[model samples]
Target: MPKPNKLLIVLAFFSIYVIWGSTYVLNKTAVAELPPFMLAAIRFLTAGVLIFIIAAVTGQNLKISRKQLINTGIAGFLFLAFGNGIVVWALKFVDSGFAALEISAQPLVILLLMWLIQGKKIKPMSLIGVFLGIIGIYLLVNQRQVLNQDDSYIGIIMIFFCMISWAYGSIFVGKADMPSNYFVNTGYQMITGGCMLVLLSLIFNEEWSSPLVWSPNVQLSMILLIIFGSIVAFTSFNYLLKMVSPEKVATNTYVNPIIALFLGWYFLDETVTLQSIIAAVILLSGVYFINTSKRKVMLNRFGLQQIQNKLRKNKVQ
Candidate 1:
């Protein structure tokens, strides 16, 4: 097999960052018309089938051991069932920017989980970053205009729970014995999780007929969700998770929120306040610290005084 190109890796990274970021606005648009769970089910199911067909043609084996299947199911439950499902529902009541603020805390959640479960210590700088992230969240949540716009405290709270679900899902994926083939594992998870979501929509008796009432704009957004958000973004993310550190992969959490914020502003006429800018900067800086601090430590241990030192030297030369 030919080695993967570096450019391809870079493109995948960018794709996940940009595409997933846009999902917040997309979700808001979609749920304006479609039931949240039903939308998620349809998105993932369609993505799963498309990928499955591609896999078949490419001769990618769909077979997985029982243990791997279980792990995939668990990941699906955590990631899709709760992480995504709850966020979609939350959008019915919250602004896309606010939703982005809440979910952007995934890095902090990952850090705390690592400390509690893996016996890892948080570095002081990283701790400062966490503090800043909290401050950012505070600014965002307390914004007076934002509060007046929707005033659904319950929806904000729901997004927090969604953050927790995503955090847990990320930790589970970090520890699970996943299959070697990234696409296969992703496909299995999406299929299982998507089925569960469909079942849930039925159990809740959510009116599937509501979709017919959606505006053409909402319909277009759903198409984007399935094609770009579900299929392209997820596949890129799973591929990166296999190729890079989980910490590195989760950096998208930070990047995505910024993209979502901008998209929300441009498309939804969502206002971006001074507070929003403050919060976004702090949150992303915290994510940077949390994700990269450990790498700096490891590099120091190996006698690399500065991780960026070589790059600087190369540029100077």
Candidate 2:
């Protein structure tokens, strides 16, 4: 196999870091003017269609086995439908800044779910990281403060559900049987989930025309979502996933909250409190430790020593 280009890898990492980081702010703006589910549906629908058309023109096979289609649809429902849908809905009541903070707790949720469902063992230090992340989330939620505020508690709960749904979706996607054409697979999933969202929007009787005066802002955010979040970020993420370890690719989650926080502050005049700063530090630290835990660096060190000793014994004997 040809050696992968280091430059391309670097570029992929940069794109994933920046593009994904900006999506939360974009989502916040989109939801501010659009019916959350309808906005999500439109975003994914346009993105998915454009991607599929491009793939077709490029002569990529869009066909999949029945099993593959089913799996893809299932993943779409979990990840985009529930995961992203709840996020869009939560933005209605939560400040984008606080919403970003809540979403940053996802890494810890994923870790705990992996342990429970897959019977994976976590390292001691990483377990501390999980606890710290939980504390950060507790601070972010501010149940005492939010309970008295109108609809704040409900929004917080919705964001928490968003986190859990995303965690579950990530796991499901990992286990799913994917198609050979990754781009096509992604397109299908987005299209499927987007359609589901549209159906849901109708069921909830969310008036699509309610935010007519906010059209310009909503349109701009939608365009950004389709171009940056769906197209650019997804392509960068898949490229990184193929070229690097999954753990390394997952680092975008940590990077995204930082970008979201800054963008929310700059564009939305969102305040960053001491608690937010503390939460950001603790959250990033927790994500770092949790990601590294998967590698079991401490255990690997012992394994390496054991291998060296075995080699020495063979030589001596």
Candidate 3:
């Protein structure tokens, strides 16, 4: 590969690491003021529309086969509508930092899914990661504060399910037929996922409010989630996956939790217990073990070889 732009690389890495980490706090702030599903729906719907507008204006092909559309839609429902939407809902009960810490175990979840569902063999290093991850999760969840909070365990459980959906979606997207254009594919997933979130909001009868009526904090959080979290961060993510190595990209898994924890404690007055800190250390260490495994294949967001293949065929990387 030709030499990568060092400045662009740094900016891209910063975007994915910090911007994506901050999304947990942003979502927490917004859902406090707006109905969770509605908040997610609007954020995604707006981002999806803007992405499409950008795609069209830039002359990217928007075409897809029926099967590709179905697969992409299913992937979107798994990845965004359910994976992300449910997390937003749970944010009402869970601290944003805690949620970020929990989600950091996604690689562990993916590892087990590969063993159970796909019958893929686990590397020895990954097995150790799984062991540490389990202990970490126990420590993270078995805290007195979390147990004392009303329905917080329920929120934690729901977020666990969200991780499953996210891991499965990653595996699915790795093999499923997607739109050749990565940007266009992302646009479709956003629109489809946003539509599903809207449907969910209606089914649940969530109270909807106009953006005009939101508090300044909620409005700013919403804007940040849509513009930076969804658009800029995702674009940066795809760019980095293509420009650099997946192992380097996977560093975001651990760094995000740290940022979330600090931001939550500083801005939202969320608690960060001593035990929670220990759990984060162990859990993220586990994720590190898995990401650094010599076997370079990815079952979750851990590896992007499959994604890079798709981008190569499209030549959009």
The lDDT leader among the candidates is 3
Model 2 scores a TM of 0.87
Answer with 1 or 3, whichever has the higher lDDT: 3
The local distance difference test score of each candidate is 0.81, 0.78, 0.85
Best by TM-score: 1
lDDT of 1 by residue, 1-317 (tens): 23556786798898888888888998898888788899999888877888788899999988889999999898888888777887888888788977887778778877887788788898997898789888877877887776775646777888888777777677777667887777777788889889989999998898786546778988788889878887777777767766666667778877787888889999999888887888888888888888779788767776664646887898999
Clashes of each: 0, 0, 0
Expressed as tens digits, the lDDT of each residue in 1-317 for candidate 3 is 33578897898889888998999999999988899999999988899899999999988878899998998799779878999999999998889999999999988877777679889788888888888999999999999999898899889999999989977776676566777666677778888999999999999999998899999999999989889988888666655655654445656778899999999999999999999999999999899888777345545544576787788889963
RMSD of each: 5.0, 3.5, 6.7
Estimate candidate 1's alpha-carbon lDDT, on a 0 to 1 scale.
0.81
lDDT-sorted candidate list, best first: 3, 1, 2
Off by over 4 Å in 1: 1-5, 149-151, 210-214, 302-317
Report how far residue 7 has shifted in candidate 2, in Å.
Answer: 4.9
TM-score of 1: 0.89
Residue pairs with backbone overlap in model 2: none
Better of 2 and 3 by TM-score: 2
Task: List ranges where model 3 is wrong by over 4 Å.
Answer: 1-13, 237-251, 295-317
